[model samples]
Target chain A: MDLPFSTPAGPDARSAFEASVMRHLDAAYGLARWLARNEQDAEDVVQEAVLRAYRFFGGFRGGDARVWLLAIVRNTFYTLRAAAPAPSAHDAFDETLHGGEDGAPDPETLLARAADAERLRAALARLPAEYREVLVLREFEECSYKEIAAITQLKIGTVMSRLARARERLARCLLEPAAEASP
Target chain B: MNCEEARVLLHAYLDDELDAAASLAMAQHLAGCAGCTQRYRGHARLQQALRDPALRVSAPAALRARLAARLPAPQPAARAARRWPALAAALAAALALTVTLATWQTLRPRAPAGDALVAEAVSGHVRALLAEHLLDVPSSDQHTVKPWFDGRLDYAPQVKDLVAEGFPLAGGRLDVLDGRRVAALVYRRHRHVINLYQWPAADGETGTRERDGYRVVQWNEDGMHYLAVSDAAAADLDAFVRAFRGASAAGAEPAR
Candidate 1:
């Protein structure tokens, strides 16, 4: 059964909606940071989301403002991403160059430390934006299969399979480090 | 359940979209397939780890200051609507409030978490039973799965295939437990998913031991702790334990 999500946002509802968005400041910013991959750009996206949310605060149906705010953040991020150059200025760390892990407690003891976080960032920079985009959404955004679907406009199944393959390729990049170290 | 099927259902498995019959099937398969289990756990852990970095960067002072100065004190809905055309929706909502005193709650709807982690395990278990797609990365050769874990994590994880001998290696994945990332190897005998969550120990501490409704053999050795859980007949899981325990003790450390 399809039902409209909007209920009535009375005086109480409006205040509650604002408060609700306030609570999700961290979450919304977190998501923006993941997508933009830079603190500044992420902040820019968050700012845009907040403003848009304020502008349309009236249209908001009174259920789950957090989800609504996040949805807005998702929408706003792509718009900026399309206009923004090199998305890296946003400061999101792509883990490709680090080649995955090394050195923690001790070298061998540290299973998969991002000893190569820097290297990962560089390697990630070299990949096509398509691949980098998926990794950021799946890895950093941690958006659910459905959420990713909504954000990327891809089917849920596509999101999963794409993420799996992307990780596999990323793993390949990371694994080369071991081969380089050996012999 | 075969590896390909498990891969397809991995998302559904995580979302808990399958019904009871199917979930049980996957559980049975993951119980004994090492390859499938590792992929599942790894996907999950990676998802979690990737999000942690975004915890919170305290809105930069510059951004916060800019926001405070530019944004007006949110005008009272009534007053703002008159001054700013942009706040028409806020005005509309306020108007609706006065016209109808009906109580309505909208926003912050609770979610069903049963679809995520624990539910994923059950879904994985069930699908394996109905179909043979339990192992996506099929291999009796520990060499295959062991290598897959090479660049994935620090210590190569042990993925043993003992299904033919009554103790089947289901699959493996990277999982999180005890606040540390670990490997969860799946094994099975009949209709149980034996989740063997393993993580390299910090200083080399074997884990705890206890018998819940299920049989769990958890202990740390060399540098990793293994927690093997199952709903199979206790004795059968014991057989798997004996075989696994023996392998490590006998020095078949394929996970270099």
Candidate 2:
């Protein structure tokens, strides 16, 4: 539980810090890629995240290093997003087109007809950042609600609701093509 | 529970987040309600599809290598400032204790060279433990731990298996002492971790010192300077030195 930053940074301390952070690189990259929506952007975000994590490593209290690292990645991604230009027209379109709607067909029936991986990725890519992050953490990372709450800094109640909404939106998006084709 | 309540709780149910009683209630509701059960099935399928390992990309090897190569070494000035104050105090106390103890016994006066090295060794040992940098290549096998230092340092340090003597080999790490790289072979004695640092020696000599509640035993063998540091009792470290010397003498290999 030694705060790594408070201890004088030495090569040994740096290596230990590196070992803890490196173990979660893939997971961090995965979250970054999903959030940033591209490999190049993800690479940039993760590299920045690594640097930020190292800078503040001395503050890290020992626990689940993966969760700790992903939280940093999340923060770094948001910082980068804030610095970038405003969301594009397509992003705006995605928001308005797929904004949560009530009285949709049952998600089970909608998802049953959804197509393959590419479509799933497109559907996930279209979700708002908040919803996408929760869904990805839960389904892809296999994080429990508590962990998701910690990583996303959301209350457990918010996490559950966002997850529910994310699923609803994803099911709606995935079912769109099927509905169009049959109608 | 009705369909409306079941729908609200379904995600938590899928995630196994609900408490036992609530989970049981949801299970009971799903059993009786075909609609909620199908919705549950759909949620399960969505989770399964999203879990496609392909969706979670592994960080590319190039990026990993880049980050490893690019990570800044600890700033020397900052490191010195942060590491030395506590050590200087410990060394001062050790010097004081040495002076007091000298008048009471005819024990060999503490070697100045050995005293400085022991302080450095103790600092390295404590830093490794506190920072959780006990090992870079964690292993029990001598061969595995020995080869890990290859190409990373100028000389090969001897590694040995001492599990039979209750000091099991924990692992090895490269440490900087006296402004040069030295091999730190780690061993565990019950709950204590002992750091045995080895570098090329200029002369044949042996000594021991105590600093900040830790004992350090130093020796020279086959042109290698060996300094072992730990918070364990002086008697225990003496036994460790004996076992280490015996093992190294029996299995000494040509230094590379």
User: TM-score: which candidate is best?
Assistant: 2
lDDT of 2 by residue, B29-90 (tens): 99998888877877778878787766678899987886764454454333423654433333
**Candidate 1 on B1-256: residue-level lDDT in tens?**
7866775565456546556887887777777876666656654544443445433345566755554432334344445446544433433433343222112212324324422223323322322221122343444455565665554455667666575567656455443342233455666555455666666664433332332234455566656666665556677767777777665421265345
Indicate the docking level reached by candidate 1.
Answer: incorrect
Flag regions of model 1 displaced more than 4 Å.
Answer: A1-14, A86-111, A114-144, A147-153, A178-183, B11-19, B44-48, B51-58, B75-256
Model 1 residue A176 lDDT score: 49
Q: What is the C-alpha lDDT profile of model 1 across A1-183, one tens digit per residue?
A: 323234323456445655777667766776676566678667767775775565456566566666677778877777665543344432343434233443111212122533345544544444444455566655554556666666667787677666655555444444444533321
Clashing pairs in 2: A4-A58, A5-A58
lDDT of 2 by residue, A112-183 (tens): 644377778888887778888998898878899999999999999889877887887777778775523311
- TM-score of the B chain in model 1? 0.41
Q: List where candidate 2 sits over 4 angstroms from the true fold.
A: A1-8, A89-115, A178-183, B74-256
Q: Pick the candidate with the highest lDDT.
A: 2
lDDT of candidate 1? 0.52
User: Which CAPRI category fits model 2?
Assistant: incorrect
